[model samples]
Target: MSADNAAVNFSELVNKNKQTLARLKESPRLLLHRRDGEDLVLTTAAKAEQDQTVVSAASRMLSAMARREPGSMELLLDILPEAFPWVRFLPEPDVHAFAVELVDTMRAADSIGNNASVAQMLTAWQHTAEVHSDPVLLAALTQDHGTDYGPVRHP
Candidate 1:
């Protein structure tokens, strides 16, 4: 199914399963219950730790990108193929150039009161282009799953 239709169907399902959804929304880390009525909090701790790790990794990646570190482009390229499968066929130097251009654009955009990250800015730009230029958008207001082909990973 198209993403937009899937989203509508998913929203309908969520509305139908409000009770279960409420529990999930209330405590995403609520993973288990003990026999003595006490709830295990380890899961919550683990989740928080994982989140912090991701943030830390992202911070390091962004710093490297900003500094134009030697290995930074390689790291970025590694994730690009997974996120944008077409990048798998692109030459390493080309990918590096593209990443550098993207990061520079993101930095410039952030300086002008638009503080979105590189990924966010790229996605927004592509979305805008798809909306304005893609013939599919004219035929049907379908969702563009540009980033849905693969897993998003820390650079």
Candidate 2:
């Protein structure tokens, strides 16, 4: 295939993936939470809004990074304000440790052929959580998302 053809194909793939994501976002299971202590179960409208927010944020972050902008990190951080403040409280090295754990989880999920795309997208979430370690962020991640990284628990 020619280089131009390959580029077109790649763009088509990205668009198709976006459409699929939109459908998934419209599903009933997407969870929505606000910074103002309000949580809403995902209805169709709420899911669409949340989906757009997440997709737009992800796209902007990726574009900023691709442009090698110095402010890319800040832009990425702004999209996830809930977690950014926590990084200050966490020991610096532990941030990367959480990222490693999340990577392993993604690999595991991929090995099982279980929603590999979503699992891969979760790397961004892990990255954000890894950097920020405030009590509120940690608690929200652990309690709400089941991402406990504390002591081991026996079932």
Give the alpha carbon lDDT tens digit for every residue of 1-155 in model 2: 22221121223334675653454344544333345555443246665567556655554445446346656544544444354445444464644444344344544444454545545555565566464545776666667665668998798
lDDT per residue, candidate 1, 15-69, as tens digits? 6655433443455443333455644332245667676566555555565575777
Residue 57, model 2: lDDT of 57
What is the C-alpha local distance difference test score of each model? Answer: 0.54, 0.48
Q: Which pairs clash inside model 2?
A: 86-133, 86-134, 87-132, 87-133
User: Candidate 2 regions off by >4 Å?
Assistant: 1-42, 45-50, 53-56, 59-63, 70-83, 95-155
Residue 97, candidate 2: alpha-carbon lDDT: 47
In order, how many clashes per candidate?
A: 0, 4
Question: Each candidate's TM vs. the true structure?
Answer: 0.34, 0.25
Model 2 weakest lDDT span, ten residues long? 1-10
**How does candidate 1 fare on TM-score?**
0.34
